[model samples]
Target: MTAAPHRPPGAPTADGTEIEGRLDEAVRAVRAPDAVFALSQDGRRTVRCGGTAPPPPVPRDRLRYELGSASKPYTGLLLAELVRSGVVCGADPAVVHLGPGRPHPRRSAITLTHLITHTSGLPPLPRDFYRQGLPHWSTNPYAGYPAERVVRAFLRSRPAHRPGTRWRYSNFGASVLGHALAAATATPWEELLTERILEPLGLAATALAPAGRPDTDATGHRADGTTPVPPLLIGGFQAAGAVRATPHDLLSFLEAHLRPDGTPLDGALRTVQRPVLRRGLGHRHVHTLTWFRHPTDHGPMYFHAGATSGQQAFLGFRPDTATALAAVSTRRHTGRDAFVATAYGLLASLPPLDRE
Candidate 1:
């Protein structure tokens, strides 16, 4: 459905041609306001697509997109590094770092592992978050959240289920973990990530919270695709859902996860992808750090998808084939499904690995 391509549709490239074609048609198929995609295979070889149609690609490396909860894996990777350095262990309860006082054991029993895997039984958000944040739905929802308030919320609330008992996505849990990691290191979360993960990995373009570089950021589209949505700042809970980066930055990140050599965090990267919890019926899939394992005809894929108020992002890698893909779109709600389908379709188009 894309504005007709001059090249024959689905022309061959080193990257899967059929998938690339679908990637093009998909944008027109769903009529996205704007989107970008990147794929990597065999560690270094990379292919990227931008624009609503195909040719005259936008600058993939400089056009920034809000990563949303796609940022969680970065946090997970940092936790993996801390584990390697013996700075913190996943099994250790998160309360070890909360300051000013200790929380009651019943309320503070959640561990770093529980937080990373979404098994802490905390709700998708803290109860107070929406109560206080809804007024800012069109502005910065988390503009005023602070460390003291976060600790107070944890200490005062009761877990929906016992820690590590069941899976429930919790932005609150991740924020707590991020805060704890920051405290243990005696550095702010953004600075801690920069020194330990972003800098060491050489990902200079990735932007966490408190970083405002509008010159490079993309404009988000609302459901109608007419009015533009302003940039969102995740404030104190940034580690849970606020990260912005270019498609090129994500391509480098995917390569690091699949092939960790020549990188400083090789061991931690490998560990971050290992499955820890068998979730869902028949245990057909597992949760690894912040990644989700879903069955596909080719094999099991470990991936994560994120949505902010105005943006959507999908990042996935076939662990068996070491093929990775990242797709980001400027619109949210229905637009999310558009490119999510594009990304998964691309993955399905990948030829299965030839096992000896």
Candidate 2:
């Protein structure tokens, strides 16, 4: 963590070297092969520090990192879009999109809200998902688990709790939600996401598949920082954790949450910010979409973190402070990784510069 926040040559910053130093320490502590950290306040001043994987080449703001579970918030945003568009109400049953038919066990009970809030009572994944993925294990666990299995598990499985009865983080629920949204909109899950959220937000660099983004690639890496790790391919669980994007794109997305406009999705964007569940005593410690809120002395910060086989990511924004932060790296975690800790630490340390 000794390296100063080394801003890439041409990248500019309004923040002092101390701010860059705070961010620099984290990137060093994590020893990421490739990484990016950016902070914005008052929607104007922005500063970024990047870490390169090996040598001569440097990490750029546009270098894509697998967003993993952080992508879930985007899924949540899409859910809000569907609700605002009248495709399905928050409380409507998932069966609503399955069309007219005798719904499978508990299928009629799961709602879009349940899926987004991770309270649908579904398991983390389908039963056979591992059977299909294990063979690919350290390779691409998700490659064989395709759209068919996602639909199969979602419809056939029975929920442990009546919809909305309990809160459990279920990748299966998020995955099913993606397909359900696609069904309602008559589009594929990826296409629906791109049209509704990515394109509108101008996250042009994000991609569901490696082939989709051909210009560059940041393959996931092991803790050693050299052994390449295969990406967690997007099978049917497109809504779960299969998206990748650059720090520049994520900051733009975060900026939108802080300062909304009179766009087509303003209503949906607003919905994504408001909390619905009482997860803790403070107003900020609730869940909205896939974002979890944490109260800071400065303000409440809404954020989420994600991990793939070889990548880790964090996305957080504090509305009361109008500050947003993001960090990503090719190096993955094993238990309590430094990257995750430093991200949360930075968020805690950054009291809105203009809050006074």
Candidate 3:
């Protein structure tokens, strides 16, 4: 790992050239066809783009990138907003909104809190996920599993462990939470998210994939970084991994989390960052309602990342420095993919800038 770049004291922010250099370096390291990097610090924001992909006629900043499971935080925020509005509570059982008489395996034991926190003891995907997804596993694994199927599976499937007794990252749990929230509010999952989180945060460019603005969306690539892949169409797992946004909008979302004093979601923003559970050996790591939390010498850092069939994205921020970052690439993530590592290293090593 390289040392954090030293910023000259009193420097307002990293200049454009410096930011461009960082972006270009990562683009080369990962050999991404298209990449964008956005930074927000102490009310100042900058975005840089570099890659070999043929630039669209429109400005690069206008292009949207898929944000796989990174969308979970937004779902978490929606839950918090609903809770603050008294439409639902974290302690409420999943069955409360999952339609009565379905007879969930966990019944009242699996609460919304458990679902969002990844402690619901649910598996990573539905039992039939492989059976249904195998045909289109590479292109669109979740295409066939509709919301109705997901809910039904949950009611009939048995949990390996008791609710809230384990810490397993479950896409299935996230999907169920989205549907439950929708049921409680009597709205569709997309509408509930748009009304509660996206609209309030002014994330106009952020929307579920395959439905975003077509004119300027970024084309995703296979691991080869050349072959194009269709947009991922996650039927029922929308909450688990279906969000996308331009680099600018993604950065804006993280900035709101860093500094959310008077915003409509101030309370909810703070709520998502509160430590909700501890996992890992000796419980050394931390997880908030929405984000993965890690302590640093400067302060705590919150971050989430995601990957689709042909694209990958990372979102993170350091509250102490009022620094937030959004990184996106057209190439899919692989074991050797340096996109995630480079993006994360950049965030972890950003100089603690002036918070004024």
C-alpha local distance difference test of each model:
0.74, 0.77, 0.84
Model 3 regions lying over 4 Å from their true place:
1-17, 100-107, 212-214, 354-356
- Please give the lDDT score at residue 41 for candidate 2: 73
Which window of 10 residues has the lowest lDDT sum in candidate 3? Answer: 1-10
What candidate 1 gets wrong by more than 4 Å, as runs, is: 1-16, 44-61, 100-103, 210-214, 352-356
lDDT of 1 at 237: 83
Ordered list by lDDT, greatest first = 3, 2, 1
In candidate 3, what are the lDDT values of residues 110-177, reduced to their tens digit?
89999988888889998888988988876888989999999988776677888988889999999999
lDDT of 2 by residue, 1-356 (tens): 12222233443334455667777777777778777788877665455655555531334565677887898999999889878888778887887885424555566778888988988888888888887777876656777788867887776787888777778888888888888888888898888999999999888978887753324556778877788886568678778998888787888888888766745678787888887887544543588776888776645788999988788899998776567888888786877678988888887666545322
Ranking by TM-score: 3, 2, 1
Candidate of highest lDDT: 3
Q: What TM-score does candidate 3 reach? A: 0.92
TM-score against native, each model? 0.87, 0.89, 0.92
RMSD of 3: 4.1
- Which lDDT value does model 1 have at 233? 77
RMSD of each: 6.5, 6.4, 4.1
Ranked by TM-score, the better of candidates 2 and 3 is: 3
